[model samples]
Target: MSSVRRLRPVWADATPDPAGRPVQLSLDELGTPLAEVTFVVVDLETTGGTPAECAITEIGAVKVRGGEVLGEFQTLVDPGGPVPAFIQVLTGITTTMLIGAPPIEEVLPSFLEFSRGTVLVAHNAPFDVGFLKAAAARTGHAWPGNKVVDTVRLARRVVTRDEAPNHKLSTLANLFHATVTPNHRALSDARATVDVLHALLSRLAPLGITHLEDLATATDPVPEDVRRKRTLADGLPDGPGVYLFRGPGDEVLYVGTSTTSLRQRVRSYFTSAEKRGRMIEMVRVAQRVDPIPCATPLEARVRELRLIAAHSPRYNRRSRFPERMPWVRLTSEPYPRLSVVREVKAGDGATYIGPFSSAATAQLAVEALHETFPIRQCTRKLPLVAAPGASACVLVEMGKCGAPCTGHQGPGAYAEVVDRVRHAMVADAAPVVEAHADRIAWLVAQERFEEAATVRDRLGGFLRGASRAQRFAPLATCAELVAARRSDDGGWELVLVRFGRLAGTARVDRRTDPRPAIATLQSTGEQVEPGVAPATAAHPEETDLILAWLGKPGVRLVAVDVPWACPVRSAEGLGDPATAVAALVRPRLAPDDGAPVVRLPGAGTERELDIAEARPVTLELDDARVIPFSIRPPRTA
Candidate 1:
């Protein structure tokens, strides 16, 4: 079928270029009087549900500025097909009525011209906007990207469900005593929607939503009580900082940091657009906003982590349970055993591996290590003299332990095994990884597929945990480090890191030299001893926080007091474990020339699989005998 011909406008056009015209006002100018803003409320009656299968039967719209109607546009369009019986009965538009009407090709261009330079409003807007975009595409016209607001969503925020049974246009119209009643005809519905729009906007005025941009996010869930606290942000300085919301009892409710203006970020919580229910509740209960200004964004982030750790705020989820975080440590005994601990004690003489997210992950890493080396897994205090009646554990009988508790294994032999475990946890994980690879291969060959997969996942998890521990270990050992990043405003953000904690931070303006500021901060910073307990030094969470910031774009390592490096070769070479596992479990597809295909569970249709381009296979572990070794580029400073 030939495409429909494009039609040029016959009327004199005075519309400006939508792209060149400025729509967003500056934050300072956002208080522009709402009466000057224009709105175009639109409604459409369609033949079906979605744009692809539907055609618009009629269009109706009204333009208003500041609550007063300026103009109206209405039209009937011929869909060029028989109207469905149900649609005709619902819309009262039959094939006979549309016989003499103009086609959509003529109706759409005029409607676009009428609605130009105005924010479009509709009840559940996506349906009308989708149909308009589809009609424009079919008729060879570019769909103008216009700002839109949904009245249904707005009504839900302004009028509570208890006040109005539902947010339907008719229900809202009756509840608000609208000027026009909705009867489902295009014009009546559009007019009713306009009334609903005004009612919602009137309610929004008290909530400090006067700007056009504010209308778009008005449906966000801010409680009525929280809206009154908008003045809490009145005198906050516009800079990078951490903000704490305090409850009535002076307890911290939530903690957050912003690189932009602290005033702007905290003020957003009082608006209807803040939709996180937990945050909304936190804001509602908050009696004051406490702003802790920082010299740089990095400092703000570090302070936020420290504050969250200190207060363990009810609304702060992460970095709040540092005491509960698991640490993988070797016990201090004649025959040391690996154990997951909640705290690292002073003078334990034990080599520590992690402050892992959970005990389960730390235990998994320990189990993977035990599988490779015959280490003592029993918990006992073995002395130079053995107990008279002590017997070996079952693990020792099964050849999994060295029986060090019963003195069957000498200190020299057990010491060698302990050294191997320490090396695997600290420097190299190759031995454990190779052992797991061999076991997985043997299981696969014996047709024990499930067991093989389980062992493979365990090995992956251990490698990931070990690699992470190694990356952060240097921070704990370093005496001092200095890092810098170029801020968006052309300033240098200098970070003074002592051991693993952020000691100090300062922002050096581009107009001035940064050397003096950096030197001053570094000289006055706190001294941190290597391998100190977290209670005495900076929390482990601070190290992770700094590492994450250093990984972001525009950050650079300017200087370091000591050298640091990640391993050049290790299990990290296998790449991300999740990605590797996904490749193994993903269903394979047969050749596409109408061959019968067996559908695997969770796999897409055969056509979808056929259309997908083949990805180059990397580190595939299908052959159990092949061990993948990764040579990573060493990161040094």
Candidate 2:
């Protein structure tokens, strides 16, 4: 995207203009007079409320300029099927009447011709306009670039509750004393709306809104204080960045970012497009907008996260809370068992898999792992050597637990279970997936579909959380890595990451070599310390944003301080956890063609697993595919 040079806010101390240059204003400032602008009052009758599935049965429009009718256009369209009885009663246009009429293909071009070069006016603009635009897309016609006005919004701005109980078309048409009444027919409602439009414009005339362009502010009338504060957005750069609306005493009121243009995004807060009531309150109290421009979209997103975290602005509620989700951790102790916790400390030497949405999900995932490895489920800590005279629980008698806490199972035997649990968390997941597959089949054979589904979901959540942690581990472990991708503007977008945190970013023009830029980035980048998990080093959301950008098609690694690799890589293409589990259970992960399957007590027997029954191996993100996107000049394979 193109960018404008950053300058001081409009309310800042006045700077004298350059001697020869004259001030230029946008067309919006000196707008076209309302009397000179032509408007097409339109309404539509459709088979249903949804535009995507429903077909338009009729179109009605009346073109007017300076309170005088110029022409009228009306058509009954064949919607290619029988109209529902409810719609027939509401519209009074029967399926029999539509059978002999022209289809949308024949009627649309004529309607477009009649309403060309005029502003569109409708009671509820989105409803009427949505159907028209959907029709255009369905019939291979380009939608027109006409401005639209919603009379309902106009009445809500100007009409008082005492004079009109509601802003509906019938209420407004009767209040304005129109010659026609709205009866849900296309042409009748269109003519009634024309009278309502004239009355609403007259009310707006005294508010200094005499031009067509000024109608935007009047339709959903902006408070005068908020309107004057639009100057706060002036001189903001039209580039990707974070913008903070600061209140009195220099406290940040809200923080927002735009991947396209900071200027446009900040400016929108003062317009009708920003409908949130709290945001409007934030804008009203806002004294200034501070724009923090960055080299790439990834940097802008990271900066936004950091600002929201630091300030905890009242209006920014979406991400105001810290990332405190639960993670299923393998405790680093004598007899390792699964435990769920929020905080992660570096160098713990325990397998960590999650950042699950809730503690319940983390616990369910833990149970799935326990189904394969008979790890202890008790919460109390166990010593290196079990306590003397400790009694074993019934779980040991049931063969569900090794009862390491009571010394019945030695540390050496418990160590074997811990290793397999670690491997399932960090490496291959076929073992856990296979164990659940056998139970699900047995449950289904017993006609227990709900239990089978529960088993399926538990396995899905476990693999997904495990896969996600494995995905972030490689990037979190690497101390320093620099990558680059071809920017949309034919330039290089350089990204510098340290221990999974976005350390720095830079943009190089098409004509410049990025090597020097990369060198400067390394020196200027944010210094970070690597942590045991990605969340320990940085916010999980921030890591997710950086990973998403880096994993895109054009991204290439320029250099790395160490080898970066993950064990639980995708076998098929990118997909959700449910699909991943299905592939693992059915045909994808079956033991065939020399593939090893662990022989467990409850898991399937050593039956010859059909190789063809397995899902095709996941979309490879291994070295063979990743090497192509890596442009590091001197790296050993």
Indicate the TM-score of model 2. 0.63
- Which pairs in model 1 have colliding backbones? 220-272
What does candidate 1's lDDT look like per residue over 1-637, in tens digits? 0111111111111122354322222123333344567778899998899899889999989887655577888888899898899988988888899898999999988999988888888999999998999999999999888899988887777788689888888898898778789987898898888777766776766666655645655676556577667667766777889999999999998999998778778878877657788998887788888999998877888789989988989888886877787877777778888888887787889877667778888888788777888887766567855677778888876678878777788888888999988888777776776676556434533445567567766776677667667767677667788888887779888888877788888888789788898889889887766665322256666777787887789888878876777676544454544334332332334333443332222223222122123321222343332222222221110
Q: Which residue runs does candidate 2 get wrong by more than 4 Å?
A: 1-143, 149-218, 221-231, 320-323, 441-457, 533-536, 568-575, 587-637
Query: Relative to the true structure, how large is the alpha-carbon lDDT of every model?
Result: 0.72, 0.74
lDDT of 2 at 395: 68
Report the Cα lDDT for candidate 2.
0.74
- Least accurate 10 contiguous residues by lDDT in model 1: 1-10
Q: Give candidate 1's TM-score.
A: 0.66
The number of clashing residue pairs in model 1 is 1
RMSD of 2: 12.7
lDDT of 2 at 115: 78
TM-score of each prediction: 0.66, 0.63
Please identify model 1 stretches exceeding 4 Å from their true place: 1-118, 122-128, 139-145, 150-200, 211-214, 217-240, 258-281, 293-297, 331-334, 345-348, 384-391, 441-461, 488-492, 507-517, 520-536, 570-637
On lDDT, the leading prediction is 2
